[model samples]
Target: MMKRYTLMVAGPLVLLGCAGPLTPRDTQQAIRQEVAQAAQPQPAPHAMTDAQAQAALLPPLKLELPKGAAEPAEPRFDLAVNGAPAQDVFMAIVSGTRYSMLVHPEVAGTISANLRNVTVPEAMSAIRELYGYDYTMDGKRIVVRPLTPQTRIFKVNYLAGARVGSSDTRVISGSVSASGTGGASGTTGSGSSQTSLETSKINTTLNSDFWGELKVALETIVGESGKVILSPQSGVVVVRTTPRTMRDVEHFLKATASAVERQVMLEAKILEVQLNDGYQTGINWSVLHNGQHKYSSGANTGNFDLLTGAVSGSLADALGSGLPAAAGTTSGIFGLAFQTKSFAALINFLETQGSVHVLSSPRIAALNNQQAVLKVGTDDFFVTNVSTTSNTGGAGTTTTPSVTLQPFFSGIALDITPQIDEKGRITLHIRPSVSVVTEKIKNIDAGQAGKLTLPLASSAVSETDSVVQVEDGRIVAIGGMMKQSFDDSANRVPGLGRVPLLGYFFGNTSQSSKKSELVILIKPTVIDSQADWQADAEATQARLDKLERQPQTP
Candidate 1:
């Protein structure tokens, strides 16, 4: 007998050894399989490590640690006593302000296989036997109290695999934890840990495919009736629904993944560019003449015939020589001859100042029952202001000269068409209706003749301008003196005081009854020149005639 002695081993033991090395081909094959499986897809992928997940999921980005910075060794936890070689085990370490994790499928697989048919308490017991730690669930949180005085709390969510059939089963677990302090200065924390073991095949549905279907629906609906405004700075499309209702939101989401898509497309098709520019024209007129005398008095005071002859001679000279040739043509008159010296002086002043553009012209109609049309043109002529004055010599010898005066004033509208040629220019055409009232005051001195006359008592003038763009609009009852005068005695008189102490009064009077009123009627479209419309037509005909007269090329 050769000392036949044998020793018996006790319980289960794990021999610590290096993992088997994987060949390059084997590693490549495994990686390809993983890539193919992941490409099949389900939910959006979670692209973060365990540590990164915890940092992102945590409320604040800070952690607290003990006074001195000390790094702890990696934690090692046991999974089973007699576990299979290919089992998987997952571990998380919390040290100071840092959290890390390690996974070992060999250990995890061993534990899963041994506890396949075990109860929850038995599983817990097995875990304690291997790692010397205990775990308990408090609602959704898992509480792991170490033997040390430091207590740590962990928030966890777990999902157990569903039973598919009698022959197939799967299991999974996940947990997250925090320890030390609260708030931003809290100590190290670990995200939920997860474990899964399955004996059945899984059928997954791809979410990308579902989203693709939704996007197609959205594009169809938005193509029909949708309007979008987008910000140039940010490429964000703000979405709005048709009729802006809850139903529209639902419709949009079901059809399109986002509203921004519609906005971007709409913004690309808008036109961006500005068009405004033109000229204006206007016309005015005044008439000055002498009325015949009613009766004659004395020879020394001068015969009515002699006075009338003097007045007529003076008027003929002034109207014939003083007035411009253009005025005669427009007024349709060979000349305007008044039978009064006062009227001649008035015409002289007006013609010298170019204020006699339309005074008593051939263009003016006769004072007959038939209406006469006066055609005004804006081609080379424009009227700005009009005025008149009359003075009569005292009867026989002059004590103080008897005077009668009238003045017409207005603003001239100039042609701005050259400045802006695109849009039509503005032009003003005026037609005046005149009514005169003369009153004679008595109590005349021996050398004086009693007389009171408001020359431009009441007048109706119509002004139309294309530049004003107001149609059928007429400025009526337009009457005022371009120049006015006041005697030094005006201050001595109460009612006449403060009547523009000196110089001309260039504005309208304050008296409502005496003031001018205008009624403007606007047309949908603008006209070039209301005053010159007919004149322009005639001018155009004349130009065509002239052109026809010129020799044509053979």
Candidate 2:
């Protein structure tokens, strides 16, 4: 007998060897057997539909591990599926693992998955993450369902100052008419009299959009049962819709209100300088040709007259003493009459010192208190290079690039609109556009307006927009322009003043310098109707009268 050797170790041992290659037919049979074996991996206790999964649930698997023995981890899956229902993908992922997955009927969608050696738990987590599905684990079973859509309520305001009732609702008023024929008792001429009362009822609501315009645009998305509530008196618009639809409604409201609202007041301070401490400012200004021509007009105040520091009047009327109004120019704010005439007064004051210029006048396009449009005209110009390619002679043939001048006119136009809320806060939308007028090379036969102009221009627009929220009655100041003035003069004895180099000693030199800042202050308020402006005027007059009646203290 040959000598036998025994080997002892902490574990068992086995012999390893490489297997010989099999024929194509044999390989096919082998693959089929492997797939058949895998088909029953992690077989469920019983087959169940999504609806029945909850009722015929998988019983908890009670497992016990020996002391000092390692617990088996979740099985990994190498699954790949193409254009399969989500349920099938989940089934593939859960096969061969300790986990069982149940997909609710609401989770209806197709899935294409490529998983590489991923654990069952990891694969389940990824499936939920990618699809935004919600899942919960019960023992070794996982339940999944699609998230339901959420609902939200949004609030906005329009037509502020109207008296909306406690319920924030309004009723429409209709007219009632009464017509009767006269009955003759004796020798009475037939006659008819009609009486009408201006009071009736209807169902209607108004907003900056006027008659709930956004409602129609959102109906398709919000569905037939969605609700839009309008409170005219409180200026509040309440929208109750799904989260996705609410977003669309919000976008619609911003656009619709921006197009038609206007009513904004700009309080501007225009000042000039005389000396570092002593200043002379009595000026009124105007602009022509879209802010190109700017000039000032005022009265003469000799010797830099001293002024009383006590300023109690409006900024417009502070310097009204020596300046005369320009012809065709009105004295009130934006051509509107209020009790206080301080705006013109301020213009009068600015003209006395130096040349005053109005770079831009506030332009109002729409005046809806709930929404408004404020604009300032700005213009710019530039040139751009053009390049073109063509197949002229033959296949790869090309011509030399030609050179030409192209004139382009670009201007800045700011369109600002605000969405007012119930608390008087505003979500301001500012659209700043660069309007381009491309100069088109035209024939001489074009009209005079086009002929005299080089490269006739066609209008186009490019815009950038943003939103900023601010409270009502707040002042926003825009400032950039600064001016510096230097005044130097000398009074000399008549004959000695002409002496060139030696005249320095005969004359006195006086020099003074002054600087000023240009500022524009914008204040927005909600006015449902013109009556609000009238109320403002009456209130101003009352205050002024009250001041005048009070005795002054020396």
Candidate 3:
């Protein structure tokens, strides 16, 4: 009986020890235990020896980082320290990484940091910025140094040259003439007279001594303790100065480089408009600005007097604005400036005025504060002066006429210099000139019966020089340069026209006066980068392609 009771109790214990189906609550408990085990802190990373670190470290890459590049991913770590030596903290940050550090003996300051999920470089940078600790890294070794004078090299990309520019503009009015008589008969009388009148004059000069100025500025900033070495030929500068002063120097150089490296492309179109008798005053800019050919632009129209044809100031004002005073007040060229990006629209607008003729289309590029010139025409040699020299020789006494020839450019010429400001405004010095050979007769007295008739070169020139401020991609216009011509035509039978005396009776003659105005438009585009330059080149190429595809004319 006793043995049966023992076996029954043992059977119940065995049944209790047997496995059963798992419940949802029991599985949740097991998952919780596993998550708790995973959340525990991981073992510290193993420190590496110098050789091991050097073997594992990658060679430093000398690469140019693109602009606005994001920071690269790095291995992160957690740090919690209080009042630890800076050297020890730095050593700890670089431990287990592919970097070995050497701290200066003077680096004895204490560092307190509680950073988590921070990278090695980030931790070092934070400590340096906060504690003024300077450091430099080699391929696999980092050297921490105390605040001291350090030598740094800088690159200054500028030409090793100086430029000096000067311009003088003067205007004079009226003229004076004097007659002198000298007689030789034992008594001689001579008279001399002179007159000078300058109504106004303007002078502009610029001296750009970049290297000298930079050296002076750097030396001043460095003072006596620091040193500055400049080599403009190679566009390099080396300085030994404190960190704070070095930072200031860097900032100054950055600003200067940005300012000096800017460039601009200048496009000019000089056109002639033949008035259709109705609009004889000038190109009606009001039509372009407010009428049917209204172009979308960010132009300020308050300074322009397009309507009512109001004259401002005097002839001086016209001259100062780079418009020839010969055009007269009735010519109506004043404040006709427009800002737009489309050259086609401007040409279409000009067609509405009269018969449009493109005189010249010139394009050039210039750097900041640099001058660029475009000349498209022929330089013809013309007799400017003639002198008669008499010589008494054994052969005979003869008078020889000595003629001097001078080259006269009879086409279009444009001279421009641009100064760009930080706000994208461009100040331009514009000098545009147009010249054409005119047919005229000149008579000179040769102390003989008839006279000396020489075909002198008579050239009609219209030129203007002025300084103006304009926005980028804006079109500045100068007009009111007018040319007048007279044409006489006769209609008759060919055989009847041959009779000189009676031809007038048989043929009828007609005379007409044709007047035309010249207009100059200039547009400046700022090129901020190489991409902009390449884009312009591509556009020019496309234009050339289109032109080439057109049918050839004989």
> What is the Å distance of residue 45 in model 2 from its true position?
80
Clashes found in each candidate (C-alpha, N, C closer than 3 A): 40, 27, 0
lDDT for each residue of candidate 1 in 1-554, tens digit (9 for 90 to 100): 33433222211222224446789657756765554444442443766787888987885856876587566643343334354322122231122213332322222223332445443345445655555343454442334433221222111111112112111111223334432322233222222323343332322121223233433554454444543333323323343333223234345543332221211000000000010111001112223312331111110110011112221222224344433332222311111212222323433433433433332222121111112233223222222222222323344322233333443323222111101113332122222222223333333243454343332333222222111111111111121212222333211334344357532233223321111212121111222333333443454455445665789777
Give per-residue CA lDDT, model 2, range 1-554, as digits (tens).
22333433312343323445789658756755554444433445786678678655765577877678587866665777777888777777777667778888877677767888888777777766566555678989998765555444445445444322110111223444443333233222223333433232222122344545545665655677677666656556676664445656778777766544535432333222222232323112332212333222221111111121121222224345332243123222111111122444434444454445553444343343333333344343432322333334445545344334654446544455555665655444443333446557655554753542234556554332233343454433222224455799888989997799878888898997665534333344556555555555554455545665789776
Question: Relative to the true structure, how large is the alpha-carbon lDDT of every model?
Answer: 0.29, 0.47, 0.74
Q: What TM-score, to 2 decimals, does candidate 1 have? A: 0.12
User: Candidate 3 on 6-110: residue-level lDDT in tens?
Assistant: 998999899878968779658756755554444444444897788878867965667876789665567788999999988888889888887789988877788
Per-candidate TM-scores read 0.12, 0.26, 0.65
Higher-lDDT candidate of 1 and 2: 2
lDDT leader:
3
Error of 3 at 307 (Å): 21
Alpha-carbon error at 130 in model 3, in Å? 11
Assess the local accuracy of residue 550 in candidate 1 as a C-alpha lDDT between 0 and 100. 87
Q: How far off is residue 515 in model 2, in Å?
A: 2.1
